[model samples]
Target: MDGNRVATLVGFAATLVVLAGLVWVVGIDDTLAALTTADPVALAAVAGIALCWLVSWGLALWTVLRALGSPVSPHIAILVFVAAVFSNNVTPFGQAGGEPLSALLISTAADTEYETGLAAIASVDTVHFLPSVGYAIVGFTFVAAGAVQLTRNLAFAAAAVAVLALGIPVAAVLGWQHRYRIEAAVIRGFTPVVTTVARVVPRWSPPSAASIEARIERFFAAIDRIATDRRTVIQTFGLSAFGWACLAASLWTSLYAVGAPVPAEVVLLVVPVGSIASVVPLPGGSGAIETVLVTLLVSTAPVSAPVATSAVLIHRVGSYLLPTLVGGGVATALGVDHAASPET
Candidate 1:
């Protein structure tokens, strides 16, 4: 098997271990009982909304690509986006584990520069933070205006999200300002490893440091082009915000299905905060994101542990499992195995 398949297997194994531990902690009998009571209508709505979330993000990707002057058809954009999701779900470290394949797929689908494709996807992900924090702020306002009482734990989660929202933009700015230093560091760190691998493998040759630097420059240039397009930025942000709403709605519906409905405000606050946990070195943030979601639900609303656990499991059926299955099929159809580097 190739390295990507091996990493995917390892990630799946880790997720299974986490699932077993989670079931033990939450009590299998109670959770199973809760799951059995789920409302079919509400669960159906959750699935629909989850697909809508995928579509919204796909259009956002199209917008970013157009802004970069490397446009693909809407259908192609959605296909690439879903395939990218498959890569991410099966690998570790969220996008870091999946971007190379995503980039390659985008490049082939759009017939654009590989760096341009990477820039478009990266920009979409970066802009997603703005809307997430925007929704969180809206939820925070409801709490601040005495509309909803929040527990200390939920309040702290919102605060941490606030910090992250601020940190992302600041880090982006600093990274841009020191782009050359960053470029030098990456090349310095990567070149020797590439060289050693090429020497031992004998099948592939390593790229020179100069070529690596050139690719980095092209990547930055693509980012610059996308960043400068104000109209495209607004459109991408709007789509991202809508996507966030769909995701929030899916979670809320999942809870409703399990007879533990929370306020929409609570879902908005928790979904984005839970997403932040997804950056952990776990495939699709599998167990970690679910844990955060359940914890936040229990803390912020009138949700029992078993109900919350069931709700989250229902949510993942739509968000994680469904996407992985569909996206994996898309990836196979599009030959994404040939797209992502073997290092994945």
Candidate 2:
């Protein structure tokens, strides 16, 4: 096997091992019992929240794509967005793989240039980051009010919030101010990866570095055109904010289903913190997020270990399993899973 294949297999194995350890730690019997004992009404409520989340994200993607002049149907929007979610969570390189795969899927579906699709995807991501400032502020206010405790997990969460609060804005400013330089750097960074993907994936033509750079320049030009419009900016960010709110609400509903209800403030504070763990390379960030959630519950909330484990697992079912299953099915239907060959 080549190095990339070996590395991919190793990463997959490591993810499985971590997940197996998580199951063991949570206790298979206890976890199963907890799941079985959840309130049917609460589960339904959580499912509703998940459904809303799906719609909100779909709308956000649709808004960006339309603004970029590559509009897709709502049905296509949901499928591509969910498939991207599954890709990001399950694949190595975290969001790196997800965004490219999402753009590829969009290009395939909409008959648009890959560059145009990537620009639209980038717009969605940019809008999404704009809301982290608000989330961090709300979380910080709760911490200051002492409604949310400064437990180790919360501390980790707070640090993550700080990073998001600072990093994203600065990056945006820099990218905006130095669009051409940044675009060049971005193309430089992505070229090797995209080149590798082109080699491995059918229907892709490997391009010279100069051609890759030209494509990236076109991507940024497309993004800049969309970003310059005030209405597009407002609508995209508005939908993105609502999408994040749904994620927090989904977490709150999951906690309620296990009868370990916390205030909405607490949910907002911890959900983002736990979610930052998803950026880690582990599949679905299973081990890190479960640890973070368990710690957050035990130290910050009134829940016992058993209840915390159950609530987190329930949340994972809605947030991770349901979307992944649906997205995987969509990927199969779209022929995304079969797009690549073993040999470049």
Best by lDDT: 1
User: What shift in Å separates residue 41 of candidate 1 from its native position after superposition?
Assistant: 1.4
Q: Which ten contiguous residues of candidate 2 have the minimum total lDDT?
A: 335-344
Candidates in order have lDDT scores of: 0.84, 0.75
Compose the digit string of candidate 1's lDDT tens values, residues 1-344.
69867877888888888877877798889999999999989989999999999999999999998877788889889888988888778778777777877887778777778888888778888898898898887775664454355567766786767776787779889999999999999999999999999989978989999999999999999888878889989999999999999999999899999888887788878888888777877897888888888887777777888889999999989988988899889878767545563643
Lowest summed lDDT over 10 consecutive residues: which window, candidate 1? 335-344
Q: 187, model 2: CA deviation in Å?
A: 6.3
Q: Over the stretch 1-344, how does candidate 2's per-residue lDDT look in tens digits?
A: 38855766677788768766776776777766776778888888777777777777777788777877888898788788887777666666566657877777777666679998788777887777768668856965776477444556666666778888887678778868887787678778887888899988999887777887788778878888888978888987888888778777777777787767887776676776776676677766666777777776666667777677888877777787788788877766666543652433
Each model's TM-score?
Answer: 0.92, 0.84
Candidate 2: segments with Cα more than 4 A from true spot: 1-12, 23-32, 147-149, 182-206, 336-344
Model 1 residue runs over 4 Å out of place are: 144-152, 336-344
